[model samples]
Target chain A: MVPSPVMLKPALDAIGKAIDQRFDKLLAVPDDSRARLYEAMRHAVIGGGKRMRPLLVVAACDLFHVERDRALRVALAIECIHCYSLIHDDLPCMDDDDMRRGKPTVHKAFDEATAVLAGDCLHDIAFEILADPATHEDPFARLELVTELAVQSGPAGMAGGQMMDLVAGDVTYDLAGITRLQQLKTGALIQWCLEAGAIMGRASEGQRKALRAYARDLGLAFQIADDLLDVEGTSAKTGKAVQKDAAAGKATFVSLLGLERARAQANALIDQAIGHLSGHGPEADLLRAIARFAVERDN
Target chain B: MVPSPVMLKPALDAIGKAIDQRFDKLLAVPDDSRARLYEAMRHAVIGGGKRMRPLLVVAACDLFHVERDRALRVALAIECIHCYSLIHDDLPCMDDDDMRRGKPTVHKAFDEATAVLAGDCLHDIAFEILADPATHEDPFARLELVTELAVQSGPAGMAGGQMMDLVAGDVTYDLAGITRLQQLKTGALIQWCLEAGAIMGRASEGQRKALRAYARDLGLAFQIADDLLDVEGTSAKTGKAVQKDAAAGKATFVSLLGLERARAQANALIDQAIGHLSGHGPEADLLRAIARFAVERDN
Candidate 1:
């Protein structure tokens, strides 16, 4: 049975609060000049976004009954990577975004230099959190988390995807090229979130494979939803510029596939994503709900 | 007797070659649009700088007789951190420098967006290398390396120091303030190098304490030398802009202590740095030579 997307709301709100509190505790402002750096980081990370990635992590961990605190730690690490990337991407050199999450972007709020350093500090903190003994009882698990996050976010992953996006205006990409780009840019970290859960829980090989398959389809569906939002979402709702890919002449899922076809494709991907979890029962309801939310979310 | 600083040259050259080769192998360009990003990273990392940090890591590991391969992996990781820091620092919003290590800065060689992503990619690569099992037979050791590097390079360390440096024009830093800033900025990573070696070797606490003391003094002396160079060296000799600190009215060791007093203090610190290594014989000679070279080198 398909779960109601409304059920995903409670989990999303709970994860959002947990993540905000964790960042607040971790980024206490120092009474020094460096306070500005911390503030910039806090400003960028403390209150923003859909918390989608962290939610994905927590939901995956639920499948294995991983400790909430342990899962939260991994969630925070991935969120930091996400926040840092957003901060850098919004810089005048990249996206030139002024607003994020309905507030001034880091560079817009605290100058370009501070934004750069803040993004960098957040990047360092992600690894520091993953490497902490508190994150996992076994050192091997902690190491695995660190390695997966690093590989998924570095070149050939998120950063590599961003590079492709940066040159998208000049290089004409067909559907295959766009799919590859999204897989690296947005899909890689999303994939890491599920793998992290499996690592922490020490899930069996078959279980891990099931989660991997779920993540892959969910990631693609998530990107398709994002492309759809870019075309249809209001700036007020999105909290940042919309229609940017189209304006830049960059080929996106929506740009290549007409509006009706793109909506159909997103729904199809979500259905496929949900199908990947056929082996699990009611325990996987949150994951199923999230897959629906990926396509249904307005922002 | 103090070894001649000249003895440090052979080790420096060898580590430089090894690091360059490793980066070359690690960053083979993709046959896609992301090739620009890889080129920017290779440009920033390959065939550049004195590689002081990597050399320190290798030398410290030598004290414990850790496998040369293991030490090199750790060294490459640290070097990546250092290189990424340089690339970011040279950004237009940061130090705004054009040349680094006698070549165009990454942002100058590539576009600003590519430079930003390249620096981030290198930052990711650093943790990936440390978290790899090949870096250490023990997962605990790999986790320790990742933790130490992240802590030393994050908010309370390198990035924090950079924030203070950025605000130096507005903040009136006295001797203590300047010292604290430098300690966090430069001293932290140098301290990490020594600790990494100790961790890999599983050194006695007393030995770790000694290296800590040595690193503290050497890092300060290195900064003092840098300040001295800023005041007295030519841009051509330094491969970067010179005397910008004085022009900006920022207080550095040389500016606060006067040239003669600063030079004398550096020499004294070097003497103290070498004194911390007195417990060991010729195996410690390279470290001793490095301590002397820290204050004596032109760049």
Candidate 2:
């Protein structure tokens, strides 16, 4: 049932192409006074990364037999939301981050005002893209995707998780607290990626539930690996500061449980993620590869 | 046609009560760890403002003989969006104001980070409320409301207009540019209020267009009067810093057209808004009253 990595690559490439086109279109803001806001948004989003979030979305859609083009805009919208979070997280008042993807953060590149507005606009645009009637097939399904996206990204979700991280600080929070933080902060959006794909493709209830399980596990594994990477990575390689979590006295899975246990937790999640896709055929195989890819990733 | 203000008061109060109840239900974060975020959001939204936006929503629904309860959650959601915008606009990075509704701004009441996340949470909650299946007559109509709300509040809408204002500082901009800014910044949401109400009430195409025209003109007129108020009203009475717009070198209707001409423009738009309600029965009377109220209000 393994979707050949070869097949996934072309699909992934197609998604990249679609996302890039939308990014370009968004950047083409009218040359009016508001152009600066669009410019900041473009700078934030167009600065490419692994594009993993969008890939998950498209892959999820693929699982349910959703047309690639049908899921394209939603995929791009997910990436936009992710990029906006990154931009805002890097803001001086937030994480005080200066570098993102080996380049200056939006606030550093533009002014803080533009960066704030850019983040706002990016989040707004994510919903706008999903809600675009010209792109969606079933408007109800599109609304479902948007609802999922908002729940994942907003308060009681990612933003809430961020607040937890900020408050937890150097406090020796419990494992439950750490998991809650990771789930809300990271798992939510990842869950949406899978859910959006399933919804777009009109997957059966069972498939949708299975994909949710897969995404939840995949997200946790991904975050743990991220924590591990921070401890074991180089700034030159990761394009972000290393050991900064400890320096900032921030709570992380690695800091809370040490490298060995964190690795075990992540591997366990990956196993669970793969296990959820047992009956899904080739889609399951591709998802398994993704699960492996997420935790085994060095950066 | 003018709605009896006395009769409208009870309806407006009902809208307010529904909004409070809906928001209270939605913002009940089960996780205690996010206590601060919940607290900040409560402070930002609960017991805030005249609920003018929600009133417009309820009034629009009333005109179509739809129960105000039908649009109650949406009314709350729209007001949340409006409140979030105000919070962000008052931030030092944006308008740098210290007070709103005679109280400290969100950034002042809570930390800027908390304020930012609170606004973020509220914005997301708006869409969440709209997408709730329990709130709508049918999925398609509900999704339509979602799309309308998204576009009206998004980058091409309110946020875009705010971006324009940020970039408009110190620029001797013309009337058209200023009008476009106001339309997007404020008018979009106003238009959405009417359109969403009509859709929820299952109004005919003609009725929808008529209400849309009424709302748009009222929105423009409201903005123009606001500019004039900023120029001539007392800071204590307006609950806003008088002459702040002029001090910031921001482009405004009054600044572009001069005080006398700005007043004239507002009156003209109010008249036009009234015209849109022509041929409608007593149900349309409230719409006219709101239009007149927009330009003639003291504060």
Candidate 3:
């Protein structure tokens, strides 16, 4: 794993702060008539978790010294996608989880119908942010972000991966299949964030390739870390249910590879992820710290 | 109501045929892994209603002699939004309708999970089409479509309207409130179809305003007609559950105003809708005919 700098914590916290402020401004709906919908949206998005995706976006963009405003916009747009998936995934018709982040799920706080609409509405708003000229003056960059997000979030990407998860009971998957599933479900969005930052920064082809490599390895390592947390962490810490995969008899990294091997695999992936970013200078230290954070965090 | 032109029937049929074929080609997902999601999408979109939205797009684009391919792409994008809304609306958590278009709803035919994701994936693909350079050479046109779609489809628009319908049990609405609900729920999309065409064709401000006026009046008339149909039409003909609004004790145009008055009001709206197009000549004859068809249709 890459050495973590003392400043990495502050860097991550800064990105988190920027994301929260921007989201508050964007999600503020003054229209009392639609105030309820906005309330649901604010509940789901405003107060959230690690915000690792935004951190990756900011760190990657930092590598190219991209404009902060545009980078933050992209970060906010992608964060909406992440929040929406969580909302939908927690719906009664889907995961049926009542608790998320130690609070009542959107559907639990509101209603199923409102939850669904809130998720769908968030998904729409995400694209709107990417398409705006404020996100990027270059139309190609805006279009790139829009098209890539769509593909990454569509049936060909996140939704497709979700279908596999829902039907996981009917089918059996080995390690390789489970790996592919994890890659599609979470890997795609994580990959898009880094690529989106590259698009915003107008990074070189070689730089783009390196960031993607870093993202891919980091994504898998992150998922493995999640599996580890589910197995070992408490609900109070993660702010979500623990050991759900084991309870459901679902195949996850720890289940397939054994807990010890899963831990080793995650560490190796983090090392590789850090290695890919070696071409960059100290500006990428946050990214390196994030790679270690992916596997080392308690929650 | 504008008199139905002798050519209007053939013109609408032509547009319907075009939409059907294009949808077939576009929705063909070769990846067998995600075939179920694609199946749900096809079931919801193809072999459907009058395809009125696509007709509006084609008619408006025709006024500016826009290229057929680009116009078709825009038409398809808007239709995806319409179909997605219908699919989500039919979910068990939403309207809970088992039947749609004379067949099982997406949730009924496939499952609720597939239905939800299919609607989501379709929504994503709509933006994907708009973002592509093939939609328009000018990125501003694409960006405008994206931004407009987000606002019209978000808390201020369709989703907001759906929320109103969901919480209808909690409150009562007067005629004006119900009108606002219906306009936000359905009117916005209809208006966007017209506005989107104007953008694609680079219509003059006056032309855009004229098309919008025509759309606004026509949209209300269309909804009033829908209310009337729900009261009077048979389920078999509409390929849907009729009189559901009345059964649910929901206030609609027919319930707010008596049937005869509602019918008269629809006619008046249609006449005013047609009046908006008076500035145009024979080229807008199809639009004039559609305005008449909005109120006079059986289903």
Candidate 4:
């Protein structure tokens, strides 16, 4: 069943706060010369947007009875990947965006040189987190986490997706091609979040299967919603400039399917995403709410 | 025993040829639109370097009789990290060098955008290599490798070192401070290369301790020699610019210690590095040779 509106909000807020605290704790680099880098990393990740990834990891871990501490570490790791991508994507060579979350991009707040190094460190630490025994007691489990996270976030995953996005203008891709692009670019890491809980909990094969399917549909829906926001989200609400995709003449789900059709598609995906969690009870309610929110959120 | 000049040349040649083949084989990216990114990654790593890191990995693995194929793969992975670092270091925001290995840097050869992505993928794939079951049958070993490599390469490792290098001009560091900087910047990964063999062989604790000590000294010797090159060697042989240190007013070993003392320091470290390997037999002869070459090479 869907979580009560009031119930999910508090949970979401709590997770966000927890992520902020833990990230601060992790990023407290020594007061040596390298402190500037740690400062940039902290600046990039702290006080950010909706902590959807952490929320997913937390809710999923709740399903498996995994320890909160272990799951939070994985949450931190996955978020680092997300944060790093954002930092790099905003580089002068990449998106050239000046602002994110209503604040200066890392390059602007610091400098281009610092921004690049900050992004690199964030990426580096994500793998370190997964590989650490703190994430899991079983070495095999830790290895799986490391390899899967590496592959999912590497060339085969987000990096490859980013390549496709960068070259999107150079080549024409059909809707299917675009879907594959978004699926890997954003979908890959989203799926990783869905698996984070299961990985921490070592959930049954059936549970893992259902959540994987849930994450895929939800991941696509998240992108569709993002595309919708690009077309329709106000800079005030989204904390980013709107309608850039259309301005760039890039094809997105909304562009391909039209506004009405894109909305319909996203709603369908939300339903499917919710269906996958049917086997779980109240423990998975927040995930259900998260799926709905993925489509419904203004941001 | 220090490997004779004659004995070392053949072994070095063999390792270089093997690395070339293996790198070529691993980098055959699919012939798709994303091939450009792969092409850039291939271009950055394909032809370059003395392959010292690979040699270190191979010699270390040889100490334990690890399979050649496995050792080569580890060598490939570590070299990926090294190559990625060079690519990023050449970025306009970083060192901004136009050439490497006497050819156009990746950003110049391609574009800054492609160079960034290419470097990112190379770093990504290095982790992928270590995480692969093919790297090692023991999952625990793979985890150790992944964690150690990630730790050594991340903010605390190479990335941190790069940050420090970027900020070197801003901070006034004496010899101890400079030593700490170089130790993290280049020393960490070099140490990782030494540990790679022990990780593969699952060598005894004593063996790990000795090799690590050997690696620490050798790594410092290698950097000191690099400083010496910046002072004494010409770009013609180094395949890159020289005298960059003094020109930038950087505080390198040579700058802090002067040429004669720097040479003396490197020699002493080389001796210490060699002494650490006293327990190994003929199989370690190549390691002994490589240690000397680390400090003695013109490049």
Candidate 5:
């Protein structure tokens, strides 16, 4: 889709390395009770992912010619929030899904109780990692990271969007309502990723605003592609059951706008995401590639 | 009981005003989708309990002659964490209780999904409130508040203790096990209250340590009294179903040691709490009154 596999693979590799290293250090809180919590946190966090958020961090830094190591902890911290949300969202009391990443969901793999605690602990540890001076050099930057992470993950964003998903069945859904839901549910953390990287790299306000615009557009495109995949792809390709979105009566973009129009929206968003990176030079090539990848991926 | 109504009521009143004012300001985030979550959080946080944590803040601030207003935001923050834990603990997937404070648990009052979100939102908001510069004048004080709040509420502290409680169930728990459980579950927040207050007041390390000792002892005494009340008090006084601990087969202080031995432990803890406050003056008097009140309060 983007003809930029060369750029994507290396950023993905760096994201993997950064996630593993920072995860090990953050899990070392010195109390047995807390240690147990961290063990569960480790299980959920490192379990598996496309590592998209961390990749955003590394790619954004690389785009700015900033060192990847400088953004490592922030990368892992954002992923921790992502992993934690997945764990909680998959609980029997929530989405009630049994499969995630082709494996049993956290509540099924670990005990539901442990899954709950693991998610809670990871959420806190993310902020703790961001706030720690050893990881984040600038106090103001640290504050901004913490503030952004909290806002994105908290009521006004991811969690609130989830509540809406729970209450608003697909039966009465519209395109605007579905987009609004996806914006908070899926877009907040994606925006956090780009913003966090830019902040850590000390990007100018305009550059940061551009990065955010790129992320927001890319995030919506990514979610629409996911909904399409759930509808059109097989279980083997996506690692999740195909067509379960419709079965669950979810308020997805495809469900609201039909497959054709939904696909069109994703392509438009991808174009916008790439458009925002026009003046940033070759460093932003990977980000542009990612925006294309978001809408074009098979799974 | 040390027989001092003179100090207790005033601390409670001040704490009420602090929590109400701070909570009002904190929940004003500009997102309508989150408005429902904010409403649920407001429902859980406001008009609740004796404001134990906030009282600790006021008492500790008074010890150093720091203005109670300085610790107001921190007081509200810690209370938010306390409220969140309670809301989650009452979820049907967790403790499954239907009643708290003479009314329905969050899950019962709202939906289970809303309760889960209410807890998640409150947890994030706690740190959000604490990190705001409006909470404290000194930047270092703000950092200290964040650290203390995270330590007390995160894995090593309240959440871990909660996990322990979940796993322990009714398994012939011993005195040491019960004490450790209470220390983590309840004592952690109380400890934060004292430590955060002293730190905000810029008290020396020694002063912070002493206040911590007082809180630790007070918390245990409070828990034991709560156990005794569950066994003897009516639902009207306790604001919960009578004999819930025994019915749930919970391993409480009263159940482990019998009423008489539990009373002895409560008295010992009260004495220790007072001893820890010995060097501090009128402020210590307020703490001593709290110690006496904890072991003897009807509600």
Candidate 6:
């Protein structure tokens, strides 16, 4: 059963605080010229966003009773990828975003060069954290994490997705084209979050398959919801510009399917996602709530 | 003793072809919208600059008789990092150079957004290559390679060094400051190339130490030679802008020490680097030759 927002709030709050504290510790500014790079990274990452990705990681890990600390480290690595993408996407050359998460973007705050390095540095740190023995006692597991993260976030994944988005205005994308784009851009990483937990927990193949199925549907639901937010969300509520896809004439789910169908599709996907977790019991409630929250979130 | 230029030439050519061929295969363009991103990556990486870092990885691996295929994979990974840095560094928001390796920079050939994504994609691919089982049969060795590469190329290493370089014009750096800056920026990855070989070969502690010492001196000498090239060589020879440091009024080894002193210092470092390999016999010739080549090459 899907839990209410009130029930899900605690998990989200905990993950947010955990991620913030970890980043604060990880990005302690050095007393050197590189301080600006660190500060720019911190500014872009700290005290921002809904922490949805980390929340998914933590909730997935909880399913197999994985250690919280281990889960948090993996969560941080994934968040680093997510945060780096946001910083790069917000660059003037990309989306030219001025504000992100209700504050001046990294380039606006620390110049273009620093923003670029900050994003690059974050990308490096993601692998560094995963490869460290502290992240996982098993080298095989660490290698798996590194390999998966790289594949999902690299050319065949998120970057490729962004490439499609960049050319979206020039190219007319049908539903299938947009679906492929979103799967690579957003679905890949979200899917990795679930797979990462399974990897860490050493889940059975059947369990892994179920999680993959759940992740696939949930990722689409998440993107459809994001498209909806772009159409209907407020900058104040979303903490960034809204209606950008429409303004740019990009083909998104909402743009293609119309608002009513898009909203219904998102809800249907969330239900399908929750249905994939039928084998799990109370432990999977957080996942169900998160799937619900995917469409419900304003940002 | 250092081998002759003719002796090194064959090895250089082999590595260059190998790296180019590997990149060509790895980046086979997708039959989709993402083709531009892959094309930009190929444009930046294939048939490009001196494969110095890859040579080092192969040479060091030669010391312990690591498989040629394994050594080449590590070499490719290091080259990816090097190429990605060049692409990002040439961005308009960064160093803003139009040329790299005598060709239009990635950002010049492709648009700015594609360049950024290409660089990022290459960065991700580097770790992906290292973590793959094909790179190493042993997970421990693969993890070690990933950890070292990440640490050396991340915030405290290459990226940090680049950050200092971005602020070089603003800061009046003394000789010591420039040394530290160069160590992080160029030295880190160069050092990683050697260490990667050691990890892959499972070299003993003593062997690793000797290689580290050799790498340290060689990396500095290489940077010093680069500074000398910038001051003395033309864009036609170096395949990049010449006298950029001087034009920007940024302090470099050549700018601080003048031509004669800088050239003398580079020779001395190369000698020191070669001395570190004294314990090895002719198996070390390629490394010794690389040291000599570091200070002697015009570009």
Which predicted model would earn the best lDDT?
A: 6
When 4 and 6 are scored with lDDT, the better candidate is 6
State residue B29's C-alpha deviation in candidate 4, in Å.
Answer: 2.0
Docking class of 4: medium
Model 3 regions more than 4 Å off: B1-6
| Candidate 1 residue lDDT tens string, A33-140 | 998998999999997899999998888888889899989999999999999999999999999999999999999999999999999999999999999988899999
Candidate 5 steric clashes: 0
lDDT of 5 by residue, A177-296 (tens): 777778889999999989987888888989999999998899999999999998888877776668876887767888877899999999999888888987787777788878877877
Identify the superior model by DockQ, candidate 1 or candidate 3.
Answer: 1
Q: What residue runs in model 1 are displaced by over 4 Å at the alpha carbon?
A: none
Candidate 4 residue pairs in backbone clash: none
Instruction: Fill in the DockQ of model 1.
Output: 0.94
Residue B299 Cα positional deviation in candidate 2, in Å, after optimal superposition: 2.5
**What lDDT tens digits, residue by residue, belong to model 3 across residues A1-299?**
35664556787778878888988898887554667788899889887778888888988888888888888999999889998999999987788888987789999998888889999999999998998889998988998999999999988889888887877877787888788888889999999989998999999999999999999999999999999999999999999888878888889999899899999999999999999998987788888988998999988
Cα lDDT of candidate 1 equals 0.92
Better of 1 and 3 by TM-score: 1
Scored against the true structure, residue B262 in model 5 reaches a CA lDDT of 93
Which residue pairs collide in model 6, if any? none
Encode model 3's per-residue lDDT on B165-195: one tens digit a residue. Answer: 7777776878998888888898999999999
What TM-score does structure 2 among the candidates reach? 0.94
Model 5 residue runs over 4 Å out of place are: A1-3, A28-39, A64-67, A170-173, B1-3, B28-33, B65-67, B170-172, B248-250
Give the winner by lDDT: 2 or 5. Answer: 2
Best by DockQ: 1
TM-score of each: 0.99, 0.94, 0.97, 0.97, 0.93, 0.99
Clashing pairs in 1: none
Worst 10 residues of 1 chain B by lDDT: B133-142
Clashes per candidate (backbone, < 3 Å): 0, 0, 0, 0, 0, 0
lDDT of 1 by residue, B154-269 (tens): 98898899999999988999999999999988998999999999999999999999999999999999999999999889999899999988888889998899999999999999
lDDT of 4 at B179: 86
For model 4, fnat equals: 0.73
- In the order shown, what is each candidate's alpha-carbon RMSD? 0.9, 2.3, 1.6, 1.6, 2.6, 0.8
